[model samples]
Target: MTAMNTFENKRFLARIRGGDFAHPGEEEAIDLVLSHVKPQPRETVLDAGCGLGATADAIGKKTGAVVVGVDLDAESVRHANATYRDFQFIPGDVTKLGELALPKMDVIYAFNSLYACPDLDACFASFNEVANPGARIGVFDYIAYDAGALAATGCLPPSVHSMTQMRQLPERQGWACTGIVNLDLAYAAWYARFLARMDENREMLAAVRSPEVFEAVRKRYADMLHCLEQGTLGGALHLYARA
Candidate 1:
């Protein structure tokens, strides 16, 4: 796996996400999770693979949940801790949550993060370990409708799974999938807006990022749009409960 720092610079991520996020429609996605999970005050919420702790901060503020953000990237964790003082950011791996000494959680979420995990079963097992009996697990991530086309584009991570696979993996690990929202249309719309924003600020982005980096970012968005249009790549919001 590539070091997080190599491809995920803070400034570039900020530009792409329009702030502290690293994914499209992150706030809206979090709202969806909030609706499904319905966290209460003093309940524990874990933001697995939390990049920069943006979602953790938002959830902590909105739902009054005791939010804890974890990521494998030490630098990202450091920056998250510095930027979001109200929430706790820990440098840890989602697949190894047992060693993190985290409290049992009422809700756990991953925003565009689970696709990068190489071992979905192990990751879900770890989630099961740290979750209360009735804990909710929400994941918003890319779903490859046509794996061949998605692989051809090479825009997404190697571990991107189809919707069926996603559901089955969690089910095998003691999670009962309650809902799966097909968000392909929403994702495409988000990509359209993202493309427009990128174009509007192309020069500004170019100025901050290296030529190679800027082009790579641009190509990634373009490829995602193309794949979505081709009916190959898409997104989904998955909701699950501990069985």
Candidate 2:
């Protein structure tokens, strides 16, 4: 367990998160994304950058939609398919989704995912290729308040756009901006709770993850919490529709 592995990050978070998702706000975040997307039973939902397929599984079970998940991580894709047998998990890049040749997606959502993607135009274009006309896309991830500050922490994923940059992306990519929810305060509170929980469960966490992993996580969370409190890091949910 001390060795570096593909699922180590996931395993570390799973121990702390107490849920299937690898994001802040955990189930609450999924509820927020679902409240807006509202995928019906008959609709085909695509989790564009699903990590380990938990969110997609939750989406399927909650909405009864046909869920298909895609991620660039082969290990996660395999784990997702094996763990959640009902859904299809494909190993593919969100920025090059057209090559996967997936069915026309009725709705696409990226929960705490997408911030790692440096290019949204290509990502959106690839999404357009597989998404049906009028398909909805929801992105719930980090918004760059200070890309440099956030990147230095190494706790969360890399984000390179501000709220203004994010807002302009949809129309530039031929989609309409439907809604935006600023989650700065929510994320700050979440990180505070996260750090507290980590401290409370230090002994148990040490047993679950190796010493190296434990220290790595502890340092990252501390730095992340500092950034969040300083208003140098933020989060948001951006919704869009094909036009």
Candidate 3:
């Protein structure tokens, strides 16, 4: 239940913002989120645990929705606010979401945020509490076996998702699943591309990130490669629900 520290999270955030190793399928994943939302020009949206706010910015610009991005990472919040001024990046904890002065939201995007929280149910509950009834909720997460066995092999990060456990929780809380999209093929391709990019542009990557961060990321890529090779890992997932 240990949360990622500031330094580690910052390094991960940096790669997400500017690294040459972003998954190729990432854009498609975002598109899927947008497709589900179909936000109107005047709707209010919440990008819970928005990370760098890439998805939030995209939604805001595309639909003219008032998107509010929130994250527990202070550095990430700062970067999102500074980098995407059009969107409001608020510093807050998703596990304790009600304290923020957010408006009634039409959509809540838990993009890749569930796995990062120590207690998934608590996190979901917080989102449920803040959301308007019938509000749309979208979640994209890295799903894996216990302790992410496949990730240890090399090509992906060590991540896990109790999807079976998660799906039931939302329903128990009154949110029904509307869709579940499997991005395994897309994730595998992205991992390959990311590893190749690292191999092809080692010097450039080193220049963009600190030596320590570069080494850390290099290890992560190596781990992902190994996992893919072993076939122990399967996929990343996206789910849509309604409160």
Candidate 4:
């Protein structure tokens, strides 16, 4: 079980979220996405960079969709597979979904994962190869706000993207941009709630990996919250449909 990643037997996340998830908004984010585009029982949804299979499982339970979970991290995939049986979890790259032998996707969903990708344009194009015509894509992730502030801080990942680029790239890759939302306020609030939850369950969270690791995670997220509040980093929900 890794300390920072959403993998393995980390029951502490469930303690905070009441289920396994790797991003902000927890249940609220899921409900919002489902309200926009949910796959039917006959359809298959691809969970791009699905961290722990929890998001995919959540979608399955809500819509009866056949969900396939994919992640670049093999350990996360293995852990997700071991914990969840109703869905298939496999280790693969989001930028190359077509290379895998999985079924074509009707809807693609990612929870705070796509922003970390090195080549989002390539990822969008590759997803097109594995997606059925008219497939919808939804992503909740970090969006860049102040480039100068982001550069000044070493905490945020370099892949943090602007909302415009996020829209333009996907649209250029055969996706029709349905909408793009700025979730900066929501992201700040989420981090606050998450930090409060972690503090409330400090001892339990610390026990999962180690006290040292837990503190490191706490500090990292605290810094993230600071960035969000400072307008250096933000969050957003992007929606697109295959054209």
TM-score of every model versus the real structure:
0.95, 0.92, 0.83, 0.91
Query: How many backbone overlaps does candidate 2 show?
Result: 0
lDDT score for residue 10 of model 4: 38
**Model 3, runs deviating above 4 Å:** 1-24, 146-159, 210-212, 228-231
- Over the stretch 1-243, how does candidate 2's per-residue lDDT look in tens digits? 232125667757766878656778888889988998899997999998888788899899999999999988898889899999999999999988888868899999997667777788878888888889879999887777887777776666664567877778767888887899889999888878888888889888988866767887778778777887888888888999966
Q: Indicate whether candidate 1 or candidate 3 has the larger TM-score.
A: 1
Number of the candidate with higher TM-score, 3 or 4:
4
Per-residue CA lDDT of model 4 for 138-230, tens digit only, reads: 888898887668756656567777887888888889988888777899999999998898899889888876798778777777888999988
Which candidate number would show the highest TM-score if scored against the true structure? 1
lDDT of 1 by residue, 130-201 (tens): 999889988988898999889887787668888888989999999989998888998898888888888888
Q: In order, how many clashes per candidate? A: 0, 0, 13, 0
Superposition TM-score, candidate 1 onto the true structure: 0.95
Candidate 1 whole-model C-alpha lDDT, 0 to 1: 0.84
Candidate 3: tens digits of C-alpha lDDT, residues 16-115: 4353112234566677767766778978889887776677887789899999998887777887888889989888998778888888888888666666
Question: lDDT per prediction?
Answer: 0.84, 0.82, 0.67, 0.82
TM-score, structure 2 vs. true: 0.92
